[model samples]
Target chain A: MKEIYLDNNATTKVDEAVFEEMRPYFCELYGNPSSMHFFGGQVQGKVSEARNRVAALLGASPEEIIFTACGTESDNAAIRSALEVFPERRHVITSRVEHPAVLTQCRNLTQKGYRVTEIGVDGAGRLDMEEYRKAIDDDTAIVSFMWANNETGVIFPVEEAAAIAKTKGALFHSDAVQAIGKIPINMDGSAIDMLSLSGHKLHAPKGIGVLYLRRGTPFRPFLVGGHQERSRRAGTENAAAIIALGKACELAGQHMEAENTIVKAQRDRLQDALMVAIPNARINGGGAERLPNTTSIAFEFVEGEAILLLLSELGICASSGSACTSGSLEPSHVLRAMGVPFTCAHGSIRFSLSRFTTDTEIDTVIREMPAIIARLRQMSPFGREFLKGQA
Target chain B: MWDYTPIVKDHFLNPRNVGDIPDADAVGEVGSLACGDALKLYLKLDDNKDKILDAKFQTFGCASAIASSSALTEMVKGKTMDEALAISNQDIADFLGGLPEEKMHCSVMGQEALEVAIFKYRGMDIPEHDSEHDHGHAYPDHEGTIVCKCFGITDTFLKKVIETNRLTTAEQVTHFTKAGGACGGCIPKIQELIAQVLGDADVQPRTRPEKLSNMKKMQLIQEVLERDVRPLLWADGGDLELIDIDGSRVQVAFRKACAGCASSGNTARMVEVKLRDLVAEDIVVEEVSA
Candidate 1:
């Protein structure tokens, strides 16, 4: 069977160009950039070049970018540093749809006496901007929100939300892990104080991420071992990952337009095909403006895990909300927070596309999806119940 | 990534009986996609009513689950109802060169489904009781609130399954109850009740297989740790580390997701029980709280 991979939000295959660009760093240029030796200084120059490349991708200055292990590390460092630098301000605001990296850290902070305001989102996965504005009091230290949701692909108005935080004298952070490559984001124009990006999401190798800190932003280092990242983040630099990220960002800039237009069209075609092929299927967060290359659909009365497994059998890779939490019966909190009906939440699947997703792959899925869904529906007691309920 | 047995792999790769049979003598459906597994089995009786002339199934589940369901139809294609019902979960497991016990439920699911089909053929409901007569305490009062949601076995049923199966401990009861196993939600409740029932009664224990020993115990634990548990932990963004082993007290530490889970204590207890069940019964597992 021809394999079709559509779960881009989980991660993407490393671009061959990016990998090739990183190969020299692993062997020939292997040197500690922090060392004063000429060999190290040469590696430092390459690091600087990579930094500039990343900065150019985000429309940021090279000095403002701090490298971390991954997006989660960036999220933690940014969120924790904002609160730690200003001890007097105990209130932090963020949305309910943040990745666990932000949500769990904020939860820990809440337990330690910092007040966390988890602003709810509308049914389409859009934030209640009015509610966001009201949550930002004078004591609010920071507001962290994602530029795009990983599950639903709904784009949030971070600039507008950041403006509210700015008026309140609070710093703002946006986890643009899902948006950095697919969307055009000029850090200088947006009022966001900080942003986090991951390499893997944009077809770079995993284990490297960037935190864009606005100059003069009060921050504290999460890891305090070495002077790397200018003492902002400690630990020896991941030279290969950094180089790959730089190359990946350059590729992103090159492919951004095609990614949005072609990839989006293919995603839409796939979604339309599935909708026509399958019964009782509804796109999740369909009401909001979403990332062009992502579609979340709930196949009513069928659990997500079973569908993903079935797709996997046919060499089609996709992700599902309930599948991700297979052992536990709990539905996705993001879906639940939106008050998605229990009957729908368990059946949700997210098909995230990338620049690499081909028309042929989408067609293959379109061809096979109807048979798979029908076969599954025949076996599903819940589908039977749902049909009865409909009757 | 899901390593299925060859039979299971064969079934998944080329599922037999993928569609429904028209005008089938009886139909039996077990599970649903919402349950993360589902199977619809169709049976056609032989002319003499002694054997199944043909069988077909539609299944939705993991590779092993679907394979098991498909394999089930293939197994009972020309077999008599008694022969089909006589087929054990062990038979299915053995047919598939043994399944992971966590996935043993799939085999159980297949057996229950076949039984249901047979019952449907006989114009009877899936039997409320496995056997006609009360064997020890297999049939318990159904009036109480269900405690084990995974298997739907009530507290009364738990006691009955224990006594009838000659299950001296919590793990043995799982064969009948399948409780306190999946999700490990009702473990503490089951453990509490097991202790109440056993209470160090120490009625001369049944002779265990010589293969069930300390050496076998370590080997099995090592295998489970290396095989099933480790990969599952990695998938959850976590890992498990062995802390210490002092006669019956196996201590372990959670490395990542298991480490940070609010339910770490519960996970620790579950790990202990899983280890014990896979290895030897005398073992008691605990988390080393640092």
Candidate 2:
């Protein structure tokens, strides 16, 4: 069976070019960048070159980028550094719909006597600017928000939000893990103090991430170890992954147009076809300015896990924000924060496309999804309730 | 992923008796939409009205839930009402190889549905069975003291499962009963119950703190917030005010820059922990919208 992979927001297939670029670093170019030997010096130059390439993609200076384990670490380093640098500032701000990396970290800070303000989102998952404006004050050490929500693919106005935070004297951070390669980001004049990007989200192998810290930002290291990442982040570099990520960033820069156009068209085609074929289906965060290659559709009455399991039978991979899919009793926090009705929230499925997603794959999903939803709806009690109401 | 058994996966994929039986002799429903899993069981009885001729179920839940419901129907088919009622949640789990510990509630729902169906068939009042195990504490007005607020598992239910399963540790109880699987606020309570059940005569029953007037509690919380917490937040351009005092729950609203801070939960927990240390041990601080 041909697998139609659409869960790119969860993670993506490592691009072949990136894999090939990283192959030499694993064994042949295995010398540690930290070593003083000639072999190590040769490898060190490549790491710097990789950093420059990544910096180029983000329109940032090479000195501003610090590579880390993954997006979570980048977020952790950004928030922790800001809080530590300004110990007197006890307030942190973030959106209610951030990935757990930022959300959990902010929540954890409150335990340490820091006040955390979680700005709410509109029904369509757009952040309320007024709420955010009021949330920031001189006491806030950092304002961390996501560039694009993982579940809904809703793009936040991070540049504006970061500017607001900056005016309040708060260090602003954006977890752009989902947005980095898919969208254009020019940090040359942006007020964003820190931004996080993960390698795996953009077709690089996992375990590689970049934390973009604007030059001269008050900094404290999250990991204090042997001098690395200019002591901003400390560890022997993940040479192969760093190299892979650099190559991936270059590829992403090359493919950004295709991502917004062809891949986006595939996503829309699948989403529009599913919506037309399946009755009572609606898109989550459809009202918001969203990422081009993503759609989250809620098929009312039928549960998401059932839809996913049936889809799995057909080798079609997707994801859900439903409570059942997550072990927790509540649905996705993003959906709940947006006040998505429980009926629809339980049935939300997220389909995130990548450059690799083909029209045939989109067609396969569009063809098979309605039958899957129809089958699950037939079995669901809620589905029967809807039917009764219709009758 | 839940590491669901092959049997469970098979049952979830091709759930048996997946719809309602129209004109069924009895129907029973358990759980609710808010709880994240619910099952409605329909039994079509034979002419004698004792044998379950057909059993169908409609479920809204995860894979384990659907599998449990499907397993219940398969297990109860052709069984007398008495036999069907006797089948415990463990039977459903056993039939499906085994369910994950956290998902035991799904199987429990299956057993409750069967009992309710039997009661419906006999035209008898459904017995209240909140906990997974019922150790003859079948009171008409069953309102056991809620121990685990996360799952709403009661003390009586917790005691019943602990004793029946001969569970030695709180972890085992959590596995079988799910009383402490979430939030973990009840693990200490669960531990105390375990000690009490293990016949530890020296284990003293926890004393309820002397109840204070609402105004007095609010005043005390306010004083603590101002003296201990306010200065720390103020340094950072944030502050908190006591909102409401309801029983042990001290509702607080963040002020100044902290009002919309994302880590308010952690801050609230800090307040709760601090207040518990300084003022009262049972105080639970919660953040409310301003």
- Cα error, candidate 2, residue B83 (Å): 1.1
List, residue by residue over B68-119, the lDDT tens digit for candidate 1: 8878888888899899888765567657755654465567667767777777
- Listed in order, the DockQ scores are 0.16, 0.20
What is the CA-based DockQ of model 1? 0.16
C-alpha lDDT of residue A302 in model 2:
67
TM-score of chain A of each: 0.97, 0.98
Per-residue lDDT value at B62 in model 2: 74
Interface Cα RMSD for candidate 2? 4.3
A54 Cα displacement, candidate 2 (Å) = 0.6
Q: What does candidate 1's lDDT look like per residue over A173-215, in tens digits?
A: 9999999999999988778989999999999998999999988
- Candidate 2 TM-score, C-alpha based: 0.81
